[model samples]
Target: MKLALRKIRLLVHLLHGMWVVATRFPKATVQQRDALNRAWSLRFLQLAGMRLVVHNDAARLDEGVLVVSNHISWIDIYVINAWRPTRFVSKAEVRQWPVVGWLAEQLGTVFLQREKRSDAKRIMHELADHLVAGHAICVFPEGTTSDGRELLPFHANLFQATVSASRPVQPICLYYEDAHGNQSTAPAYIDDLSLGESLDALLRGAPLTAHVYVCDPLAPGAERRVLAAEAQAAVQQALDRLQPVTARPAREAVGVQPPEPRVDVPHASHAGDAPAANGPLTQ
Candidate 1:
């Protein structure tokens, strides 16, 4: 009964959030919109019984940079947003998700259709322009989620935007632990698990604490592949230092080579896409 009530309350809160975003977000200035986004994210985490702990030796940078992080669950987006509102580059299919999809669009997420070469090129140009204009744009170079126990291969394709704009790469490390401080797997949205099952698992588990550690930003100028590897190493090292006993190995230990620069590789297979000629960058 308590679980059911929690779900109901979350649903109501989501609907309320949508209304608030739809009503006030457009009229607000950039700073005000960012404030609203952070507040909403905090409340969302609270309702879901998750606590956010940010470990930043230095203050969060406000300048334009390419933000890269380890992806564990869809909840990672909100975890970062709660700290500072950021523009995210997500797969195009995410734009079609239910309520959250529309909210993502309103919040300034760039959706990428990886299968189409033209679409990828367009997104690359837009991302570069945003970074050049001093806006932070985040991309999950892993291109997918993981179990939060190991770091997956980071796709080097998106790293090109940072290089194009000559912007630094900000690497963030994210992980979850229970109240007792043990690693929590409840939030891992890996494998064939559906979104509903992932949410149910998170809501039914003990209260979780998510750590977002802002690591040292790597300076730009290197090739995309090099930048991707360096960022991945930085995140993995942070995760290692955070949990010394866990032995979180990189995926390479099992003979997985770093993925080549995939200019046209599809991130995920999606059904038919309607053709569009010359659409705006933000959708």
Candidate 2:
């Protein structure tokens, strides 16, 4: 009964949020929008029974940054937004996902139609334009959500935008744990699970804590593949360090540093000459 009521409250909050976004966001300034995004994201997490804990290793860049992260659940977007409001690049399908989709569109998410080869160059250019205009743009280079236990290979195609814009690339790691401090999979939306099923699981589980590790940013370079590999490594290293005791052997074998104590408070790299943006992604 308690969990059901919590879910009900969350739904109400979400509807109210949608209404605010639809009505007031259009007239709000950029700063105002960012502020609302952060506040609303934090509240959404709270209502969804998740606590956000951030570990910052680099100064928060207000603009001209390409933020890359591992995708876990649909909630990962809001988890990062709670810390710093960022514009995102997502699959076009997400732009049609009911109320959530509408809210994401209103909040400046750029939707990409991956099936169309021609759209890649245009999307890359648009992302570069956003970065050049001093907006913090985030992309999930891994291209899909994982189980939050292991990272998938990152796609190098999107990194070209950062190179073109001469912006730094920042990697963030998101890990979920239960109230007792053990790693939790309650929030993961993976494999055959529908979003509705995932939400039901989350609302019914014990409160979770989301650890956001803001790893050091990497500098943009002419080589997008190298940039993608380095960003993936940074995120994997952060994940390994977060759970050192039982750190995944595959990652540990690679010599990840020892784990450190977690800190409550919050929150990148240098670049070489950028290559000309001839074709950002192979069609």
Candidate 3:
């Protein structure tokens, strides 16, 4: 297909998604919302000119669970939603992003102001409530996106709420691949690139694939920090096997250093607080 024609078709799909979001999405019931989230996210990926490759080993959740993963790009949300519906705890700035923001809010994303320590309490409380109420929630514990090549030290505080509520933590590993199956930068929203810039790169390049690997869920431990470390290790090991080392400019062992303990959360919940728990899952 001609590049121009593909882009034109992509634009139409994008506009149609926007229309649905503006009209029916916000008014939808929970089931309806889940359907719409999957549909809209799939369409959004098509519009953005990327493909999704998911390998889910996640255990079936009959009740609400906490979803934790590394942050990479805005596309991560769409990729995950294309699989199942879950509310995400995102930064407050996302609410201002024109059309996208409205769609995100309708999809039930919880916002937190990262700068405010107090906001952590409120956000964690809400997340715990949702978990207890049987609603799945996702959190990016790295606190921000990495270059899609390197992993970041995860913030442990995010796990406290779920641990406190006795909810299990599910870790997912994400990778981007090129049409040739090599790790690709075609979809990296890293560095200082704007959303439009990322979109342009995706549309103009070879088809990109977003790969998701679901790790074994870590049961709530005595300490949130230990749980966070164990989760990070799970994700890192998965990446080591699945993500090609040649894809990155850095050395093979990425994000393997013991991160300086930077727990910035007020202690309130969970005998699950991690002092660390270990799970046996590898890529």
Candidate 4:
């Protein structure tokens, strides 16, 4: 009965979100769009039956900025949304997933083909446009989800878009705990377990709790490599603070390291290069 009610609530929120997007599509300003997006996001979390603990220090919730965080379970999406209005930088494959794909598209997520460098450039350009237009973007720089036991090295290249746009980037950390009050690293990655298996585990398990902490946004003038490193370190610190004592060492081992900037290319010239635009997807 509880599950059915959750589904019904989710459907209603989605429907309302779609209607708002459709009606405001032509004339909505960036701030208005963000307001609507945040409203829908809050409703979505309410429907999902997840609790959120956020540490946000930003002057404005709707400001344009890049958010980098440690990736954990699929529920990380809901966890982050519970804090503020935001979109994600997801892999192209997510667009093909059944329900998730549709929802991601509706949320105006930035999609990329990581294997193709050029496609990444194009995606970065699109992301910059959204940022410039006052939208917040969340990126999981670990490139893949990890067990809550350890933080992964972030791909510095992912920072290209925000660096180019000269936008502020906020670092966030997420931690999930099982019912026993112990952290379970096994359920972090969706690929590690089949969708059914993952769902079953969650259903049979005690209610999980997620912790999110948002740090100060990096200044615009910081170097991309430096920015990435600093963001990684910030997230690691947050994770360390929340993680169990036994897991601390492993998480710290993989935590942030300063990335060496690529010296071959001229940094300034490549920073804001615009790529060929693609047809805009419907919101």
Candidate 5:
């Protein structure tokens, strides 16, 4: 029954989305467009049973900056847009995702063809132009999703755009968790999975909490490699700080012997994600 409701909700959303794509986009201003996009994206998550939590060093991000984040799932874009209205630098294939693709094109997503190395140079200039025009652009520098397990080495080439635009780059770390506050695999969208297959995984019992950690922004500099490495480390450290606690071996749980003690970061309090439901999968 939950799955049936999910399918019904998606059909309604796609119909409304198509109407927006055909009618509203032709006449909306940039602000108007993003406002509408934000509304839809947030509601889309709610209806899909995903809860969003945003924690940023600053109260809100500036309009024209570069956001670097680890890729996890297609919903990652919406989770960010739920807080900040921005464009994305995505691969060319996302532009082919039927109804969703058309909406993304209208929302100003820049597409990159990874097969052509020169395309990266072209996209760098394109992103820089957008930044110069005061648009926030996001890039998944790892070039692929790791299902929230590892931080892949960032492709430094994308950072060149931030340098060219002289825009500050901010790193955000994300993970999805079930009701029990542990990492959940229900939404993992990796490896040969079709969109329909992914949606099926996401539509199970309840919503998932999207854990977001926003770090301080890095000043753009000439060395893209150094910038990339710094951003990677910031996210890795954030992941370490936020990852779920692991249980000790079976013997320790049974109290046959004392378990090895561990140290943890000391803080008076932590800002945790608000309520959201989740099933069991990975993306």
Candidate 6:
């Protein structure tokens, strides 16, 4: 019954979205139109049972900026879109997902082919064009999803897009909370769980909450590698300070381990990170 309601809501949203796209395609500036479209997407996610907590830093986010964020659950896209207008730099396979693929295309997502070295230049060029056109593009530099307890090291390659375009890179942190107010562990790896299993877990879990923190955009002129590292550090700091206090039993919580001693610059990026675009969106 819930699934049936969700389908009905999605169909309504799709129809409304198509109407808006057709009506405003020629009249509205890209920013104005995208802001409205993204807002609707966010509202749909909220109706689908995702709660959002957002923190906006000093960054104005005006003009074209490369927004870097950590990936956690499949719904991170909706969480991000709820707050601002932005396009995503995703894996090419997302261009084929069922309804999601259609939505992504409408959102103007830039699809990357990571396995093909030759595609890097093309992806970079496409990214540069988006920046030049004054569109905000979101990239998951960690290149994959994690359990929300720690951040993965960002891939320096995507930072090159910001460097080449001479645009600021905004760092964002995302954390997902479970029913017991703890981080979820079931949906980290794309290959670790089947779609049915993941959906079941989400449906059975307590209302999921996503916390989003936007840090100041990095200044231009720094090395892309240094910029990436700095962004990674900022995101880690936000996560450390903002993770909600969990009330779940120790054995049942996903991130119940004791906090470690503080370090000046803790390693946020985990090793052996998988590609970000590998799950249902890719299929």
The stretch of ten residues in a row with the least summed lDDT in candidate 3 is 274-283
Residue 241 error for model 5, in Å? 2.6
- List the pairs of residues colliding in candidate 6: 152-269, 153-269
The Cα error of candidate 3 at residue 103, in Å, is 1.6
- Candidates ranked by TM-score: 2, 1, 5, 3, 6, 4
lDDT of 3: 0.68
Query: Over the stretch 152-178, how does candidate 1's per-residue lDDT look in tens digits?
Result: 889888888888999999999888888
> Which model scores highest in lDDT?
2
| Candidate 4 TM-score, C-alpha based | 0.74
- Tens-place lDDT per residue, model 4, 1-283, is 3655555655565555555655664477755655555455544433444434554434324567988888876667756664565788777877887555765775677888877878977887888887888778888888877776677788777687777787888888877666676775533545548655554454444355556666667776546688788888888776766666665663443543322221111111221111111111211
lDDT (10s digit) by residue, model 5, range 1-283: 5687778876676567667757776788777666666666667677777777665545346667888888877778767776666788877876776666666676778888888998989999999999888888888888877667667788899899888998888888877778887776677678988767877887773568776777778888888999999999877765655564362112122222221222221211211111111111122
CA-lDDT, candidates in order: 0.74, 0.76, 0.68, 0.62, 0.69, 0.65
Give lDDT tens digits, candidate 2, residues 1-283: 5877877877776776777776777788888777776777777777787878887645457789999988888788778787788888878877677776777777778889999988989999999999999999888887777778889999999899999999999998888888777778887787888777888887776588888888888999998999999999999888887764574645544566754445553210111111100001111
Better of 2 and 5 by TM-score: 2
- TM-score of candidate 1 to 2 decimals: 0.85
Judged by lDDT against the true structure, how good is candidate 6? 0.65
Candidate 3 structure quality by residue, lDDT tens digits, 156-232: 88799878789988888888777787876676677778776766776776677677777778898889999999989
Candidate 2 accuracy as lDDT: 0.76
lDDT of 6 by residue, 182-277 (tens): 776544545577655665555455366666777778975557799889999888766765664443323234543333232121111321111111
TM-scores of the candidates are 0.85, 0.89, 0.81, 0.74, 0.83, 0.77
Q: Higher-lDDT candidate among 4 and 5?
A: 5
Q: Candidate 5, which ten residues in sequence have the lowest lDDT sum?
A: 272-281
Cα deviation at 83, candidate 6, in Å, is: 1.0
Query: What C-alpha root-mean-square deviation, in Å, does candidate 4 show against the real structure?
Result: 10.8
